[model samples]
Target: MCGIVGLLVKEPELRESLGALVVPMLLGMSDRGPDSAGLAVFTELLENCNSTGVVPSITRKYSLYIGQHQIDWTEFTHNLQQIGNAIIKENGNHAIVVSDCEPNLLKQWIKQHYPQLHILSTGQTIDLYKDAGNPAEIIDRYQFGLLTGTHLVGHTRMATESAVTPAHAHPFTAGEDFCLVHNGALSNPYSIRRQLEPQGIQFETDNDTEAACRFLEWRMREGDDLETALQTGFEALDGFYTFLIGTKDKLALVRDAFACKPAIVAETDDYVAISSEFRSLAHLPNIKHARIYEPAPEEIHVWMV
Candidate 1:
């Protein structure tokens, strides 16, 4: 069993409270998933402005995690001087390095030099934090209470099919600016992986959910829009799953045709909240005024920011 939570704030004024609102929804699922927790938050995009209101070198962020490894971050930043316009903001063991330089080059540099540094995500608006531990503790360790974002996808995992480690945590990301949290298992993950591995898709884990995440991202990379990619996912991915996906500007939810896994959605004029169960969403602001419903099997529900 696992818990999947997603929140998308439609009102700009309410975006600052994104993390504060999602933490409760996540805590409510602690019993369902006590092994690990993760969250991917999408904040405002970074961009440089000229008199024309646009600049060609839009910013990109790389969320980095140093797990039980000691590295001089000062030297790291000093080294980053070569990659012009790179800036870093740190919070404990996690740091987000923002830059307008080539993200691919930065990622390769970190991997080649600081192999222990795990690149959690890379995109203009996404910042990812996930690890192996109690959900509540993970939340506090990362100061989830203070995160500001347009939307977020969160998860608590009770590892069934893989080792309990940060690398296997949910909110699994493949390509830039996208993440997926799964509440159910995928039966054909190996088959999917077999198809993607040869396509140059390198997987970071053996977790079944990674296969689904990569497959969907790959479809989009191959020119499929979100809706079309999801439709293709319906055909290629097999098993019972309630998926909560977060992109740069959208939060999407879907269930398997059987709809064996549980999911609930509560939408109000100000925001849309989703969880594995209603209990996970009971504490949201104006929750009683929200229009609540259970998503139908095979239905893809997407809400744009």
Candidate 2:
């Protein structure tokens, strides 16, 4: 199994707290996955002015969860103009666009109408980084900690069922603010992918992890809350996997029907933590004591931090 870690905090200080908490976790689980490492941080944007002097500007964070696709940026901007009042900002292979409506509402609308499009990670603050090779190398190359956020999810991949590449790495994003990193295999990912294709869901890679992200998007459009979506996913899909999903407002960990994967969850008054191994929790200072348990088969464990 691959190693996974997730954290959420209300204070900015938690950014350091999370880095401190996860570094050793990644180090400890290093052997489980030596091919690639990635992390996704989710936070809300504090009031700040942009270089363009736009106040209350909306920013977006994205991850590799969305497949890389080719779209004409110029045409995309023209279309945004037709959508009424909106602002668009582009970042490294990603875009930070906003509309007159609430970001969450706008995200929901996009999911409902453009399910097939890969629009990974939204919100005022979101960042996803992954690279080919070990976690330490990837972190060093990207300066992972320099990025700030309130919630973070990370993974180290061992490449059990898929090839090793940056694009296939963990922390896959479905849209501007939704991302998921998985640590197990979906036994029947192709079948589920087929089911979603008819709904206009598209996949850039052949990995089943992308299918899971699309599944979440589809469930969210069906009016299912995060918990409901996860629980429903456990029943609807055939697989043995554990997922660590991050949204702007919530962080969730879900187990497959058989609990074939290993996951450990620990929470304190100040924060919540999940990892693929217990030793990964060794670095957490505030975790004086931890209640470690594996998720039950077909069970969903959700924490809204």
Candidate 3:
């Protein structure tokens, strides 16, 4: 079994308050998985606006702000290349970097394509930390409380079938943008692995969670949105699982058809929190009256800022 927790803070300042909320909850779950622990925190920011009528200052650095403008990374890069010097860097679904361009031009491009995406925080906003160890040890070593952001998802793992190593730790990351932690098994991982191997998808560890990641990546390549890809996974994949997945923009919680594992989710005006056990949210300062619910069998719950 594994432990999973998530928090979505509407206000940036509330992120600082989440550390105290998460510490006890993670500790309460130590018995579920003692081999490893991990957390993914996401935030958004706006760069300083400039008078040049160039790209908005907020759109200059981190792509999360630009994402709010809904500019397609691929299309934006193509546009950038046509007019001026630009470089792009991508890590899974989380990031896109464009350098040496006019901020106003970038903003205009984003406004044209993606007007619905919102910018909530900025600058080095998302963080992923994981290691092979117990929750307390990992938190202490990582100083988890110091990490402030708009949202976070955390996990603790106890390897049953997989080897005990950092490579197999929860919050298994693909590039710098997406990570996932899971409880339970995938019935047909080998078949999936065989199919993925030839397509240049590498497997660093034999854990089924890694296979799930690859599966998601494949669906994304096939033109599926994150939620659609995961929903399709419920039909195409056979398994028993409860997954806590994190990307630069969202947190997804899913359970298999049987709902063989356990998970709990709670939401408040200021934040939304989820975990494998109830105790995880016991200490939240704003939780005067907390309602806990479980995901329906074969259900997927996604939270975004």
Candidate 4:
């Protein structure tokens, strides 16, 4: 009922083509998911903000969603100066804010002021954009074709369970440099939320995918590696799911024991591509020569940037 796409480029030169290559892959999945779509791209760290208008010596970034709301980004940046150096690069209904302030400090400020602005992801390398709309229109609005990154995770949702709001979209995130998109449902999201809420972990949306995303992220924050966190996920998460995960340097995928959802992986010397179905992956370069396979139930696959 959903479409998930991930691309990790191994050859350095292919990095610049990341967006151009992934756009077609995303467009091909328009039928599988027509409600909402999202994309998160991970790039190399850039210490200096170039062409962002307001330059700052930034150490981290927050990909924010304003939806259809309009804001004076210049004045907002001026106001944020009290906390620390802050700058923004606005892109149709979304913006990437680079800041020197702590995550909590900047988050609290935004929540207090522009409550409508939603934090999509927080990190130095990850820039995310997502919203509820026609998949193709959403892609065009966010300018997905211009993205440049080492890897990315994307999703298109059909919204069988929850409301079709931007907040309910997939590619849920927790902590820094981490995000997850799911292709199936979880039966015990409430139980999982109860387990993590006591440990001070927060939930942004009631989406079942968010529960799984935060749970794995919490495990990693507690000292488990990506693979270890996913093993823990296999035990903790209950439901049918094909999860495509993205981190600062890793792209991982896993399925529940049932493998109720569909997932296919295409790998080549230049990049690794994954999607819910092959039609979405047909446009990749030399795709006919790539080694392709369907993941086994509960199998874990991880690709490094």
Candidate 5:
């Protein structure tokens, strides 16, 4: 089993505390998943930077990987300068690399040259972080509490079906402003991957959750809205799952007809939150009086902020 937590803030004043608020929720679900954890934070790119901080461009955002080897930052930025003015932010084992280059060309350059360094997610608003560690440790190391963002979706993986590594972690993102965290295993991901590959879809890890993330992305690319794409998933994805999808302005929760997985949703005038269990939501602001309920199977709940 894995744990998934998502927060969509309705009140802008709460954005600065997004990470601080979500950490307790993630740590509370440690029993469900202790292998690896990740979070996707969506916010406007920062225009200013201090000496020891990240410099984000207003036009672009990138999620970059450093791997086990270190690269010369001065040399790397110099090379990147040829394509566009690049800004770099280092966080634990990864970096958020932003440039003014068009996203499509930037992606091409990354795939063709820096094949070893993975791009976790690329968008003007989304920054993704994943690592092999407990949720509390990962959060502390990343200093997520200092982050200000519109929303965040986090996951702690149990790793029942894949290797315990950063790549296999949840909250997998394959498209701009899109990411997903799942709580169950798929029955036919290999077959499903085969079908998606021919459509120009790419996958980094063999994790079933990655397949689900890409599938939803592909469907949305084919002109389906979030609700419609998930409806297609209900008929197409073969598994028992509870999926929490985060996009630039939307957060959605859906479960299989079998409803074999657990999910809880809490909503109030100030925010909308979801997690695998009720305890995860206990620490949220004014949560005690929120409208809390378990979503019925096959029922898709979409909240826009």
Candidate 6:
């Protein structure tokens, strides 16, 4: 079991509070899932990064060490600078590296030299943060109140079928500007993983949620619209699930045919929000006047900015 919450700020004014507003919703669902929690916030490109308004490139990579380990971060970062201009921001044991080099190359170099450091996610607008702890503590540690973004998705995991490692966390990124959080299990993740491996899609964890992430990324690569890709998931994926997918400008919610898992969506002029339960969204600003409803089984809700 897991807790999932998402927010799409329709009003520009609310974007600045996107992270602060979603923290309570994430915490409210903590009772449903308390083993660990994670979140992905889709914010603007870093002020130092270049932008073409299209063909977006990942400008930052979030990574961390496996355990109590130490390396000369200054020297390691200096090596990174040899490749291209870069900035490294350290937070506790994790670090967010902003660099001009391709994210794939940066990740590859880090893996090759510092095998202990594991990358979490990379994207221009998407920054993923997660850990094996309570949702409220994680939020406080990250100081979520300062996070500003157009939209965000979060997950608190109960670790039903996977380890509590950071790599096993939700809000898995499968492609540039794309990531997903799931609340349920996939019945046939192995077969699907095998089929995807040959396609050059990689698996970072045995979690079925990761398989679902790769599947969607592959479908979009084959020229399917986000909706079409999710529709195809209905045919290919066999399970009870509710998925909250985040992209650069859109947040999508989808449920399996059974819809055994719970999901509630609340919409208003200022923002659109989703949660595993109603109480999770109860504390939002101006929520009293919001239009609240539960998404039907097999129904898809896509909110675009």
Better of 1 and 2 by lDDT: 1
lDDT of 4 by residue, 157-178 (tens): 9987678999998789999999
Task: List ranges where model 5 is wrong by over 4 Å.
Answer: 46-58
Residues 102-211 of candidate 1: C-alpha lDDT, one tens digit per residue: 76787888889899999989888899999999999999999998989899999999998899999899889988999999998999999999999999999999999999
lDDT of 4 at 67: 77
Q: Candidate 1: list runs displaced more than 4 Å.
A: 47-58
Better of 4 and 6 by TM-score: 4
| Of candidates 6 and 2, the better by TM-score | 6
lDDT for 85 in candidate 6 is: 55
Pairs of residues clashing in candidate 6:
none
Better of 1 and 2 by TM-score: 1
Query: Residue 170 deviation, candidate 3, in Å?
Result: 1.0
True-structure RMSD for candidate 4: 2.3
Q: Looking at model 3, how many pairs of residues clash?
A: 13
Candidate ordering by TM-score (highest first): 4, 1, 5, 6, 2, 3
lDDT of 1 at 173: 93
What would the per-residue lDDT of candidate 6 be over residues 223-279, giving only the tens digit for each residue?
999999999999998888999999888999999998899999999999999999999
Model 5 Cα lDDT, one tens digit per residue, 1-305: 99999998888998878888888888988789988888999985544322435553435678876668676767877876767667788988888886777678877887786777778888778898888888778888788777778888999889989899888887799778899999998998998899999888877888998888999999999999999999999988999899999998889999989899999999999889899999999988888899999999999999987
Listed per model in order, the count of residue pairs whose N, CA or C atoms clash below 3 Å is: 0, 11, 13, 0, 0, 0
Model 6 regions lying over 4 Å from their true place: 49-67
| Residue 14 alpha-carbon offset, candidate 2, angstroms | 2.4
Task: Give per-residue CA lDDT, model 2, range 2-97, as digits (tens).
Answer: 888887764456765566566777777768888988888765563332344554444333232223555454564455444434545543334445
Query: Which of the two, 1 or 4, has more lDDT?
Result: 4
Error of 1 at 120 (Å): 0.9
